[model samples]
Target: MRSVKTLLVPYYEHPTERPDAWDALLAAADRLYGVVLNPASGPGAAPDPAFAVVAGRLRAAGVRVLGYADTDYGRRPHAAVVRELLCHRDWYGTDGAFLDQVSAEPEALPHYRRLAVAARTAGARTLVLNHGVHPDPAYAELADLLVTFEGPWDAYGSLAVPLWTAAHPRERFCHLVYAAPPDAHVAAAVQCVVPGAGVHPWGTLPHALEPIR
Candidate 1:
C-alpha cells in the first residue's frame, strides 16, 4: 500500500473555531504534503494573529502552509488576486498559495499563469491550482499541483482521469472527497486514486480534519 504521506488537507476553517483540531493537524504534519489555511471570507489583508501562529507552527514542523485565495472562476481582476497572494506571504509567511475556484477554460490559463508568477515573486515556493476538476491539459504547466477531484465519495468513485494527465507526474494531481465513510471506505477511495497523487477524505462538514493514521 502506498503511504498516506501524500495527503493534502483543505483546512478551510478559522483556527479559532477548533484550536484542538489545528493542534492535531500540526502534530501529524510530517504525514501531510501541505494544508490550505483560508480565512472567513477570503485572503484578507490583515492577518489573524492566531493564524499566524498556526501557520508558523506548521512551517516549523516542515509542513507546507498555503494561503487560500479565490479566483472567482477567473472573473476576478488579476491585480486583486495578486494582492491576496502577497498578503499570504507578508502576513502569515505561508509557503504557497492555493488558488481556489480556478477555471478550466483555455483562456483562463493565462490568468492563472500570471498569478502563479506573482505568487512566486511574493516568496511563494509552491503554487496549487484548485480547479476541482480535470482542466485543460495546458493548465498542467502553470502550478506545482492541481486539484483534479473535489466532491463526495460516490462521485469520486466514478472519476476518470484524462489520458493526457497520465503524461504528467501523478504527484502533480490531488483528490479531495468529503463526507467519507468508515476506514474501509476511505481506504477504497485512496485505492481509486492514481499512485503518487495526493488524496484526502473528510468525514463531516467542517470536516473531522483528523490525521490519517
Candidate 2:
C-alpha cells in the first residue's frame, strides 16, 4: 500500500555536515510535505551556494523547499522578516516560507495575516506558520499549514485537542514531535517525529526516514 502520511521535516543541519541525511530525505520525496531550510537560524548574511543547490534539488524532487524565517511572535519588524523571506528566495530559490516562533494569542492574528500576505507577495507558494501550539482558529486562515503542536514526545499523549480545532480539516494542522519513540503517535495529518533529543532534536532524521547503510 502507498504511504498516506506526509512529513513536514524541520531538520536544522547543514547539507555539508549531513550529506547522508539529505540524501535520505531525497529518497523519501514521495512522503515529504516540505523541508524547512535554515541557514544560520534564518538565512545567513550572504547567499549560501550549498543551500541553493540543495534547495534546487529538493524542488526538483517535487518537495517544497521552505525558507525558515522567525516572526519573533510579531515583535520582529515586518520589514526584517520580509527581508529574510527575500533572502531565502534569492539565495536558495525556495518556493515557501516557514514562519517560526509565531504567537498563539488571538491578538497577534492581524500581524500574522499581514505577514502571510507579504510572504506570498515575496514569491512563497507554500506558507507554514509554526505557532508551536493551538492558536485561535482564525489563525488557520493565514497560511497553508499551521504547526499547532510542537513539543517533546512525552507531552504528545497529554496534549489536549481543543474543540475549536475539530472544525478545521486535518490537513490544515500539523504536529511536530521530537525525542519520539518507535511507536510515537503523530496526532495530525502532517507528521514529523524524530528520536533525537536535547537541544537539537531536529538535527537527526525522523524514525520512518533513514539512510541506507
Candidate 3:
C-alpha cells in the first residue's frame, strides 16, 4: 500500500522554550516525516541532554528527527556546513539535516549536492532543502523533499507548483504557510497544494507546529 502523506513542520522552537513542542510532535508522529530541531543559532557543537532525550523519544516513536543547519545561501564554507551536519549526527543522533537558506539557482545545485552527500555520510538518511520557493527542477534530484513554498497564508493561496515538479512524485514536495487562517481554512490550504504534498500551517509568527490530522 502507498504510505500516507501529511504535514511536515519547520519546528523552529528550542525544546527549552516550548517543552510542549515535544508533546505536539509525539501526538502527530505518525503523520510526520520528521521535525526540525534548532537550538541557539543553530544546532551547536555540543548536545543538550534535554534535546537528546526528545530526539531519542521521537526516534523510538518511529519519527525522523532532523537537525537545522543554515548554509547562508551557499555562502558558508563547505567544511563548516559539513561540521554542523556531523555535529547533529554525533550530538543529537538526528536522522537527517534540514538545510535552511537554500538557493534555487541552478549554479547552486552542485553545492547542495555536496552537502547532501556530506549529510548522508554523517548518517543523515533524509535531506530536506528549504529553498522557500520553487527551485530549479535539478534540485528535485538532490534531496528527499523540497520546501517549495513558505510564507504567509495570502501568498500560499496563489502559490503555484512548476510543471516539472508534477513530473516527480508529489511526496517529494512540501509547503509551509505562516499566519494561517482559522482552523476552518485548513482544508482549503491543504487543497491548495498537490495531493501527497507535505503541508504545514501556522497561525502565528515564529510558527509552532500543529498536529496534522
Candidate 4:
C-alpha cells in the first residue's frame, strides 16, 4: 500500500486553547494520513502538559504524528527551539520532527547535521532543510524528509515539486503551503507530479512574512 501523507498543523497554542483546532485537525486527519504539531509557533509559551494529553488522544486514534520548529527564522535562538521540543515530548507525542528553515549552502550543511543529531539524541527523528525548491543533492540524504516546497499558493506549482519529483521518488518527498483560495489547485498540481505531496493549510496564511517566533 502507498504510505499516506500528513498535514503538519502549525501549532497555534497550548492544550487549553486547542479544542477547536483539534476538532478541525481530527476532521482533516479522517481524510488524510495524520497531523504534525508545531508547539514552537506560540510566543512566550512554555511547554504545557496539556499538549501531552492531546498527543495521546491523537496517537490513540491512529494518527501518524510529528512536531516542528522554525530554526531559520529571525533571532529566535535555534538552541531554544531544540530545548523546548525535547522538554515537551509528552505534548507532541509523535514519531519525529520537521525542522524547518535549514541551510542549503553546502558549507552550512554540517551545522544542520549537528542539529539533526541533537534532535535524534533527544529521541526524535530529525528531518531537516525544508527548502521549497529542488535542494542540493547532498541535502537529500541528510534528513528523513526534505520539505521541498514551502511558500505561497502561487509559488507552489512553479517551483520545486515538479523538478524534484521528476528526479526523486514520490516516497522521498513532501511539500507544505499555507491554506489559501488556490490550495486545492496547488495540491492537484503537486499530486499530479509527485504522489508524496504533503499540503498543510495553516488555516490562514502563516505569518511567514513577519519573523516567526
Maximum-lDDT candidate: 2
Which ten-residue region of model 2 has the weakest summed lDDT?
A: 1-10
Scored by CA lDDT, what does every candidate get?
0.73, 0.90, 0.71, 0.55
Instruction: Give per-residue CA lDDT, model 1, range 56-145, as digits (tens).
Output: 999998988888888999999999888887788888888888888899889888888888888888888888888889999999888988
TM-score of each: 0.85, 0.96, 0.84, 0.70
Comparison by lDDT, 1 against 2, better one: 2
Q: Which segments of model 2 are wrong by more than 4 Å?
A: 1-5
Which residue pairs come into collision in candidate 2?
A: none
Candidate 4 residue lDDT tens string, 9-94:
44445557547656555545444444556654621266556676777777777665566666773234657767755754544566
> Which lDDT value does model 2 have at 128?
96
Query: Which order, best to worst by lDDT?
Result: 2, 1, 3, 4
**RMSD in Å for all candidates:** 5.2, 1.3, 5.2, 7.0
**Candidate 3 TM-score, C-alpha based:** 0.84
**Candidate 2 C-alpha lDDT tens digits along 76-128:** 99999999999999889999999999999999988898899999999999999
Which residue pairs show collisions in model 1?
none
Clashes of 3: 0
